[model samples]
Structure formats: structure tokens, C-alpha cells
Target: MTNDEKVRSIRSKIKCMKSTNEQGFDVIIWMRKRFLQSEAFVKNLKRIIDAGFIEKWTNYLNLQDISQRLLAREGAIKDPEIKFEEIKTIFVLLLVGHALAASVLILELWYSKRSRKY
Candidate 1:
């Protein structure tokens, strides 16, 4: 299947899985695997970044604060160096990244359709 099709399929799966309680944390892992790592998603994300949406979104999200919190959490972890809070932060970052990618794709699709309608 094409990359766009793959992205659509993954998005649909995410919507479906999100509605059920069976997967739990596995749903996040699955989303990271299927959406964040998809080739089309990466390409669209790069395009969005090139268009400066990353800067705009990051500013809106106050990512610097999130980064500082993540750093503090990292410093607090000893020996094993992996804490649940750290994992949660990482997961939240992944979700934010995925949201950005999906938003870009949606905008692109919407623009394409709007242009076609004109």
C-alpha cells in the first residue's frame, strides 16, 4: 500500500483502539509504532516544520517548560534511570508529535480538496 494509505489506516486504527479499553498502554506503543514512525507521517512532519508550524505549535504548547520538567525528571532518576513519570513525559511528547503530524496531514488534505472545489 501507498504511504498515504498506510497513514490513513494507522489513523483509523488509532481511533478504533482509542474507543476500547483492552489495549491500555499498548495503544500508545502501537500508535508510536504505526503513526510516529510511518514514512508518510515523517515526510508531512518535515513539510510542516519547513513551513514553520513546529515553531508556532511549540510556542503555543510552551515546550520549553515541558523540556525543563523532563530534564528535572531525568536528573531525579538514579541507578536504573527509568521512572514512570519519565516514561509518561516521553509518551506525552510522542503524542504531541503525532498530533502535529496528523494536523499537517489534515490541513494538506483540506487545502487540496478546497483547491479542487474552486
Candidate 2:
């Protein structure tokens, strides 16, 4: 079949498989099912990739995010560089939470000791 025909076929099949209220998470679940359980779907998708038409197909289907995620899942996409600043921010927040808890405990201990002396 022609590329346009294939796209139509894929679009119809996917639409039928999807729920009316489908969102990003739903699409991920659907894609996982398609890849894992539907041999014909996987074969067609492989053909699209092999023919260098994956971008076209994904764009046509409004599945750019899903395609990127699929590539990431398959390890075709490399991991992004880690940001030390983000990690440092998280660490600082955790430290602040710990300090708050420790302060609360110390206050409780001091209150208990002062009460005992009264």
C-alpha cells in the first residue's frame, strides 16, 4: 500500500483502539499494547521507521510526543544531561525539611525537660 493509504489505515486502527477520553497516559498505554500485543501494528510501525517515514507518520497522527517516548523506551534516544542545579535544589529542600523536623523534636524535648522541673 501507498504511504498515504498506510497512514489512513494506521490512523483509523489507532482511533478505534483508543478511548474517547484518551490523554497522554492513555496514549502511552495504547502504544505499549500495540507494540507488545499487536504483531501487525508493530510490523507496520517498523516499516514506517525503516522507510524513513516515522516522522511523517507521527506528525500525521499527532503523536510526536509518543514517538519520542517510544524512541526513548527503545533506547534510540540518549539520556539528557543531568543538571547539578536541580539536584542541588532538591538536596537543599530535603535538608530544610530535616532541619525543621529536628528543630521540632528539640523543642519538644526542651519543653518536656522544663515541665519536669516545674
Candidate 3:
């Protein structure tokens, strides 16, 4: 693509990436969990994500100011390799998240117990 075209593309993408108060990854997860537990759609997820997602995701991550430097709680570590990883890897995490929290908290409980063991 031409330089001008590329710039326009990037600018358009950036417009939709406000990470704070806009990016709703955690909210999405909460909705999904709620749905499976009660076999009901607890909330309208589309409205929760409509503002940012149809816009774009990675661009949203960039525009977020989530205070990455803040210390972790209990037992957590900020690994550089994990941060350097690309956004494409999120699909893998999605699969993992779905499997862990699909229709009930059983999978979640199992994973939590196992994760702590290691």
C-alpha cells in the first residue's frame, strides 16, 4: 500500500482503541460466565462491546493506559515474553478461557486447583 494509504489505515484503526473505560475484555468474560452458569444471557453483551470491538481490538490495547507498572497481587509476576507476544495469540487464550468457563464453574475450579499445584 502507498505511504498515505498506510497512514490513513493506521489513523482509522487508532480512533477506536481507547483501552481505558472503553476496552471491555473483562466485562465480556463476566457476561460469558454469567450466561453459562444460569443458562441465560444475563446481560446484553453486544452493547457492552459494540462501542469498541466493531471498531478494533489491538488498536484499543495500544490506546489503553492501564498502569502496567502497578504491582501484582498475592502471587503474580510480569513476564516480558508474555508482553512481547503478538495479539494473534489471544485466540489460543480464548479457547482456553472457553474451555475453563463454558457452562459452569467446574472447569474453572479444576483449572484453578491445577494451576496452583504447578
- Which model scores highest in TM-score? 2
Tens digits of per-residue lDDT for model 2 on 1-118? 7444554555544422222224422122244422444556656665765675744554556576667768889889976798898699899999999999999999999999989953
Clashing residue pairs in candidate 3 are 17-60
Two-way TM-score contest, 2 vs 3, winner: 2
lDDT value for model 3: 0.48
Cα error of candidate 2 at position 72, Å = 7.5
Per-residue lDDT over 4-118 for candidate 3, one digit per residue giving the tens place of the 0 to 100 score: 3433443344444345555533221222322443222212333434466555565545544443423343334556574535766797888888976774688777878889953
Residue 50 of model 3 has an lDDT of 47
Candidate 2, residue 9: how far the Cα is off, in Å = 27
Worst 10 residues of 1 by lDDT: 15-24
Cα error, residue 62 of model 3, in Å, equals 10
Error of 2 at 64 (Å): 6.7
Candidate 2 deviant stretches above 4 angstroms: 1-66, 69-76
**How does each model score on TM-score?**
0.31, 0.37, 0.17
Q: Candidate 3: worst 10 consecutive residues by lDDT?
A: 25-34
**What lDDT is reached at residue 113 by model 3?**
88
RMSD of each: 21.9, 15.0, 20.2
Full ranking by TM-score: 2, 1, 3
lDDT of 1: 0.59
lDDT of each: 0.59, 0.61, 0.48
